[model samples]
Target: MNKTINQKAWFFVVPVFVLVAFNAVIPLMTVVNYSFQETFGNNVFMWEGTRWFKQILQSERFHAALGRQFLFTGIILVIQIPLGIAIALSMPKEGPWVSVCLVLMSMPLLIPWNVVGAMWNIFALPEIGFLGHTLNGLGFDYNFTQQIGDAWFTTILMDVWHWTSLVVLLSYAGLMSIQPAYYQAAEIDGASRWSVFRYIELPKMKKVLTIAILLRFMDSFMIYTEPFVLTGGGPGNATAFLSIDLVKMALGQFDLGPAAAMSLIYFFIVLLVCWVFYNLMMKNEEQS
Candidate 1:
């Protein structure tokens, strides 16, 4: 005889569905509406079809911002992933220091995003900030406020400092979950440090590393507040990524139509990249 399913379980899911609709679906629908129409105060709208999308896709400003956004994401991924893994590898496996190291690793991740930005802003001021003053005193011309290279370097350094902890924590967790038998077997085989890491730890950490990379990629791509606070997208728009440019268009200049279109495009690009990353990483897991 077939067992009957409990219909009551469906009732429990209603709240989550309602919450998601209220938070995500409704706002997305509003954006979709604005993307195809133009408004001039008083809720009045005129159908503009795909004019805004066409314009945003054709604009050099959008292209430049997109390039900068991609570059930032690429740079962060290159730095954070390997550094995080190396740090995780170096941490004590069993000791009081484990707790202390974990706590220290977690501190950066706990800070608020806006506060992190503000802290970096003050910390990087050329004359008064500790980092800026030290660099300048060392005979290096380090002025993030006025130089494009300095702005990029400071921004990347701030991001790596804040987010690398997340990767380390995740990697450490992945490392801890491996069975001792794996290491015992590797030892019996006389595997070197690099060999054990290559054959055992790396494979085991694949899923967590995939997750870390995706998280870093998405966060880096969508980053705005920190860079905005630190640089104000200045030094002649050197650091104005897609999100900053979108805000500038939508609110700064009140060009809502193009902004909405660009946002949708930006959303799709992120979704596509994340999908590809997840699939490729998962495929490697299957092959291994």
Candidate 2:
């Protein structure tokens, strides 16, 4: 006799599919529509084929913005991942102080993005801000508003302080998930701390590190609010990344066509990078 399989589980997933279609698929389709068309108010739209895409691809502005976006993301990943892992390793694995350390590590992440920017803006003032005053006292001519280098330093440092905790949290979770038997085996073999970390801990933590890197990459690439609030993409457009440039084109100058095309390209680059990361991570896991 043949057995019948239950097919009623479809009901459970249908709502999610419908919701995603409404929220993501429809909006993406609308963007694709605008990306290929030209508009000049009064709901007027003309078919422009790939004109906008061609324009964005040829524009030096987009090239510069793309370069800045990738640079920001690269810097963030380089700094945050190792730093977070080190911090997480230093924290007490199990003790009364663990909670306190975790809470302190998390405090910066709780602050709102715009507020973080505003706080940094005030705190970096040459005369009034404590940080600026302290840096100046230490013989560094740090002034985020007036100097391009200072602006870059403040932005990178602010991002580090704000988001590094996320990496720490993820690393800590991964570290905690390792079974005690692994440690026991390492100890039995008289493994040094470095040997244990290299052979046992690093492998276990790879999955989490992959996730942390991807999150940091995407967030840094798409960052707008804090940098915008802090710099206004000023200091001579030094902090103007792709998102900022897209906003300026779409809303500031009302060049919807180029903006829409650029946005689509921007979205695809992110998706492609994320896909590559996922594949590489899985391949590494398989090899290990």
Task: Compare the candidates by TM-score and give the number of the best one.
Answer: 1
Note the Cα lDDT for every prediction shown: 0.95, 0.91
| Local accuracy of candidate 1 as per-residue lDDT tens digits, 1-288 | 999988999999999999999999998998999999998768899999999999999999999999999999999999999999999999999989999999999999999998999999999999999999999999999999999999999999999999999999999999999999999999999999999999999999998899999899999999999999999887889999889989999999888888899999999999998999989787978886
Which regions of candidate 2 are displaced past 4 Å? 1-18, 284-288
- For candidate 2, what is the TM-score? 0.90
lDDT for model 2, please: 0.91
lDDT of 2 by residue, 1-288 (tens): 997888998899999999999999998998899999888978899999999999999988899999988888898889999999999888889989989989999999899999999998888888889899999989998888889889888999889989999999999998999999999999999999999889988899999999899889989999999999888887888888889989999999988878889999999999999999999889878876
Range of the 10 consecutive residues with the lowest summed lDDT in candidate 1: 279-288
> After superposition on all CA atoms, what RMSD does each candidate show versus the true structure?
1.6, 2.3
Candidate achieving the largest lDDT: 1
